[model samples]
Target: MTLTKKILLGMFLGIIVGIFLNLVTPQAYPTIETYILSPVGKIFISLIKLLVVPIVIVSIILGTAGISDPKKLGRIGTKTIVFFLTTTAIALTLAIGLATLFQPGVGNFQLEGAQFEGKEAPPIVDTLLNIVPTNPFEAMTEGNMLQVIFFSILVGFAISQLQGRVKLVVDFLDQANDILMFLVGVIMKLAPYGAFALIAVAIGGQGIDAILAMAKYFGIVLLALFAHLVITYGSAVAMFGKTNPITFIKNFSPALAVAFSTSSSSATLPVSMDVAQKKLNIPKSISGFVQPLGATINMDGTAIMQGVATIFIAQVYAVDLSMGDLLTVVLTATLASIGTAGVPGVGLIMLSMVLTSIGLPVEAIGLILGVDRLLDMTRTAVNITGDATCALMIAKGEERHAESYSEAIAES
Candidate 1:
């Protein structure tokens, strides 16, 4: 069977086993999770995590080195930011609109004694300042992704400008990237097993009871995710990338399956990059540059959850959000996304920030925490799809731009 087919089967079996464990054999869950699911899933994720930082550094270096032109680099950077911001805004709009229309928060929910300790978000100015790495090695060691990205881009830019003087260094990075890519290929053989173990644990640990309790809220988040995926991403792939939407999703399925199981965009980077190039036919340069950056900042899926959660929380408290309050949620979440990059448990932190902006109770975050794990897994799948969609469009635009330039030169 093909890899996608295998991974799909794994996911199918995982859901079945997870529900079985949760509903049928609850007592055995602890043993099964501790002995089997945890080890196997961790091993697979560890293998992927092992490659993420090195691959990000080398691939971004090569991507920047390939561009070499400062003007073009600036253009790509601008385009990427625009796409991320625009799509993120659209995601929030869709989420809030759906929540409002569906009235998922209409049911009776307990409001008191809901306690949650939310991590505080950093000041925007400080977050921006911290992006520049003081010590590149320390940044790499800590897995400080924004700093690492800044350092890598600088190194890549310098290598491009120095040209022949750094030929040896450029070649070294090239070979290193190749080796890492090879490692990714070998590691992915374990993906089916990993997918099965991870999903089963997630579903079993949460149990069916918790999910059914907040069924309306959970269903709204899933519906918003599906709508965004099919409507937002599908339209972008077809209209801008000039590719069939179904084909784009099909080619990118391997990465999607892994992202769903892992729930970590950073961990899924290597696979997504590989799938983008080999499967989606995106050039290595664009895939390398865009996907790494997108993994850090592009957060449409998380944004969707926050949007829905904000509205859900408001309804649970019987406080109607004014027009201005809804707008506040959008602005706060969108800007907070950039500020909170690399923060642990970032989705919750950003939700806290959004809640504060609208004067909602922060402790109310606890209400949705039970089902958040399942939502997290689904939203992650949407998150990476946004990255690939942007890469495909950028790749297409770059191609057309190059063709136009060549035609002008021929005419001249």
Candidate 2:
């Protein structure tokens, strides 16, 4: 079977098992989900974690070295950052608009103090400084993908200036990357076990009671995610890239699928870069730099969730947000996205920032935390979609030809 078919089946079966586990009494299915099923999920995520640093380091190194002209590389980087920022702004705006319309949190549901602790978000200037690595080796060991990407591009650019060294380093990394990619392929073959395990454990442990309790809010977020994917990303493809929408979607599916299951833009970074650089035929320099940055900062999906969620919370608490307050939510959420890039448990904390900006109660954030993980997964999928979309757009702008990245299955 095709990888896509296998992945799709894995997703389907995982969800089914999760739902079934939820339906069964804990006494009946307890041993299975907790022991066998849950471990599979943990292992799958562990595999992703295992591959994350090496895959990113290798891909970025190879990608940057491929650029013959360092000037073109700079241009690509500028174009990509601009595209990511623009799309992120648009995504936040769309989320606000849809959230205002749907008001996902406006329902009869009791909320408790949620378990959300936020790490510090550095000043914007400081954050930018952090992007430049002081020690590349330490960054890789720590899984500091941003620093790794920055150093990779620099190393690649330096190598470009040396003809003999460029060829030698590029060829070496190219071979190493091929081996790492092969490992990824091997891991993928074990996806079914991972998917089933992860989903069953998450579902069985969380249970449907949690999902059903906030059904309206959950549904609204999902609806907004669909709209954002179809309208925002799709429109960009149609207008800028001049690619067929269905074709773009087909090409982007593998990355999106992995993003959805993982619910982490960072974890999904390697796959997205691969699809963009290899499958889509976008240059490595563009894909490598842009995908990693997008994982860190360009969170269209999270922005949308915050947008809808803020409004939903306001409506639920009967907190009459003035026009000024609504605008505050939009601007705050957008800025918070950039500010909280590396902060842990940022979703709720960012929401709290938005609420405080509008003089709303911080407690309202608790209302949505129950379904946040599920929503987080959906948003991540859309965010990566936007990343790929931007990569294609920049590729077109650079007069770089982009082939369908989804052709990996065919090549395999």
Candidate 3:
């Protein structure tokens, strides 16, 4: 079997194994998880994370330097940001519409017992201000994505300016990118084992009771995620990327599976980049530039979750949200996608921000906390899919523009 099939099998087996452990060997599950499951999973995640900072900085620099023209760089940047924000808004719209139609929160839920201490979200200006790193080395050391992006782009810009003089630096970056991509290929060999262990841990630890208790909420979240994946991504790939959506999904499934298992957009970066370049035929320049940026800011999946969960919480609390409140949820979550990027536990943090924006109790987060892990896996898959889709569209546009320029030159 191919590697993707192997990874898929591992995930399937993980589900079966996880359910078995959860139901039959509940006693031994902890010991099993503490040693075997957690270690293997952490190793996989650590292996992926080990490559993230270097790959992002290197790839972004190369991508920006390849564009060479500052005008093209700025144009691509505008496209990336606009695509991310627009899709985020669509995600919220789908999520809220579905939640309203379904009324998943129309059941009895206790508010007093909800026990979540939400982290305070930083101001948007601070997130923007800190984008330019104080110390670029410190940013890289801390894995600060915003600062790293800022420094890398500036370096790429400088390299592009002194292209002939800095040929050696560009060459070094090319070799470094090659090395990182090779390491990604080698690390992916461990994926099936890693996927199996990590998913087993997620499913096993999340008891069946919590899943059953929150079945409606869980189902609603999944439905919204499914809608976003099918509607938003499928349409983007078909219309904007100018490719069959099924082909896109088939080619991209390996990364999707990994994202589902790992639940980290940053961790899935190397795999997604490789898949984009080789499988989806996106050029390295676009893949590197768009995806790392997308990973940080393009959070359609998380935005969908926040939208549905906010409405769900409001309905459960018997608070009728006006048309204005729904609009606020959409606006708040869409902006929060970028503003809350790089924050730890950001999914929940963003959700809390959405809750606060509309006068919902932040502690209401505890109500859906039970099923968040499982939903997280699925939404994360959606999240990376969004990033890849945006990259595909941008790459396609660049391809067409190049072709048009060639044709115009021939005519002239």
Best by the lDDT measure? 1
Query: What local lDDT score does residue 117 receive in model 2, on the 0 to 100 scale?
Result: 48
In terms of lDDT, the poorest run of 10 residues in model 3 is 104-113
Candidate 3 Cα errors over 4 Å, as ranges: none
RMSD of each candidate relative to the true structure? 1.0, 5.5, 1.0
Candidate 2 lDDT by residue in tens digits, 122-197: 6666766798988889988887666777887777777767868457677788888788777777777776666556
lDDT value, candidate 2, whole model:
0.74
Alpha carbon deviation, residue 379, candidate 2 (Å): 1.3
> lDDT per residue, candidate 3, 40-146, as tens digits?
99999999999999999999999988999888899889999999999999999999998999998998887788989999988988899889988999999999999
The residue ranges of model 1 lying beyond 4 angstroms of the native Cα positions read: none
lDDT by residue (tens digit), candidate 1, 83-130: 999888999999999999988888878777678998889988899999
Count: clashes, candidate 1: 0
The global C-alpha lDDT for each of the candidates, from Candidate 1 onward, is 0.93, 0.74, 0.92
Give the total clashing residue pairs for model 3.
Answer: 0
